[model samples]
Target: MLVEIPIIQKMVLYFGNPSLTFSIILFSILLSSGLGSLISGNKYVKRFTDNSYYYLLFTAITILIIGFSLNKIIEITNDYVMMQKMVIGFLIILPMGILMGIPFPTGISKLKNIYKEEDILPLMWGANGIFSVIGSLLAVALSIKFGFNSTIYIGAMIYLFLLFYIGVFL
Candidate 1:
């Protein structure tokens, strides 16, 4: 999903400075997500944690919003300067990336509390890797066939489904 954003931006947004836009997007996502992960452990931030449910929910909703509205966003801001456009893109991606970051650590903490005797961390890590690989491949294929917007919608649906699954099971 992170990997595909630059491609989609380049292909769809047609920013005047494509390279700069790509760099902005990549940097924004990485930095924002890192901040989110870092804050997840903070004492103040912990008070706001709702077992990671809101994080996943926000992430899903944000992705879906982006999927449905990004092109229109670009259109509305088409007259802005290239730097302004890049900044807008970065700001828009920030929340979604940050929300994306919180869930993993929260889940890990939850699992640790629930399964102290068994070492399920390795299994969770493996599952994370496998699903990430599958998701990356699926994102590429879906973006190729249906374009980036639809691919994002599918990703959001997957996130929502995962949220539902976890809500039911764990």
Candidate 2:
């Protein structure tokens, strides 16, 4: 989200104000992720087993590809009206949001299987929340120093690290 927020902000700036861009991007990600989570029930996740790692890899690849192409996307839609650009931005983000949603539920499912303790679920969620806040703050600092593109690349690298962790450690 830290990475995505800036990308969306940059894209939406071509058509709208900063506040509107922020609201739309945030709302789109939340709504899409919520839907993705709802769809990723235990049964859906259980079918994957270790194959979930591949999903994470694919998600990371997708993020990198999208991040690389974001400028082109903005250029392609530069002539679009605000409503059109908003819709395009939502469309562009929805897939990444869905992919982002998968890891949490999948990780929880794995943890549940390993620990056999439902209690740990909340701890995982809390840790995730804390890390996300820290990441967002870090992203802001990074963006200030390196610009949004580099910040996004950093986020992509983090995803790559996640893929490596899942591949080697999990």
Candidate 3:
């Protein structure tokens, strides 16, 4: 996402305002993910919350679909006004962002139960932060060398791998 923003601006929305495009994408992700986080905590969705592997699977598929069809999607929407484009972009990002949000809190909750030690939660959070920083840097390099589509595909693969881990280890 960090890597794809500029690429999207360059390739898909070259004529649009860069700042608006950036903000639309960024805020769409934040808003959708925050909504997802709120949803994941709901008692009504206990069944869904118990099975976060499905969330990861959905996220992987959504990302892969986006990576493959982004060009077509943009081409189809090219004639729309900026506001329409913003909606299109938000819709495109919403599912994956929402799915992405579910896993972290779910994972943390699971870890808390598994490891009763209070310090482990903080350690896990710190590790998550460190990995996020590392992943962002790696994403930049991957996007630079392999292009955004490949980078996105790699991300999808990581989600798939996490699904496997959750199935076996979580």
Candidate number of the best lDDT: 2
Q: What TM-score would each prediction reach against the true structure?
A: 0.79, 0.87, 0.85
Residue 86 local lDDT, model 1: 71
Ranking by lDDT: 2, 3, 1
Better of 1 and 2 by lDDT: 2
Question: Across residues 1-170, which tens digit of lDDT does each residue of candidate 2 receive?
Answer: 55775686576567568788878888889987876677677676546534756676777787788788889989888998888988988887888888787666767767988889457887888999999889888887888888888888888788788778867896
Regions of candidate 3 where Cα sits further than 4 Å from its true position: 1-15, 167-170
Ranking by TM-score: 2, 3, 1
Give the lDDT of residue 77 in candidate 3: 81
User: What TM-score quantifies how close candidate 1 is to the native fold?
Assistant: 0.79
Model 1 lDDT, residue 131, Cα:
81
Write down the lDDT of every candidate, Cα atoms only: 0.75, 0.77, 0.75
What is the alpha-carbon lDDT of model 3 when measured against the actual structure?
0.75
Comparing 2 and 3 by TM-score, which wins? 2
Query: How far does residue 38 in candidate 2 sit from its true spot (Å)?
Result: 1.9
RMSD of each: 2.9, 2.2, 2.5
Candidate 1 Cα misplacement greater than 4 A, ranges: 2-12, 16-18, 43-48, 117-123
Candidate 1 lDDT over 1-170, as tens digits, reads: 63345244543454666676667777887888888888889886676676556656777888887767777877788898877877887877788778777767877998999999999999999999998787777777877788777777777887788789889998
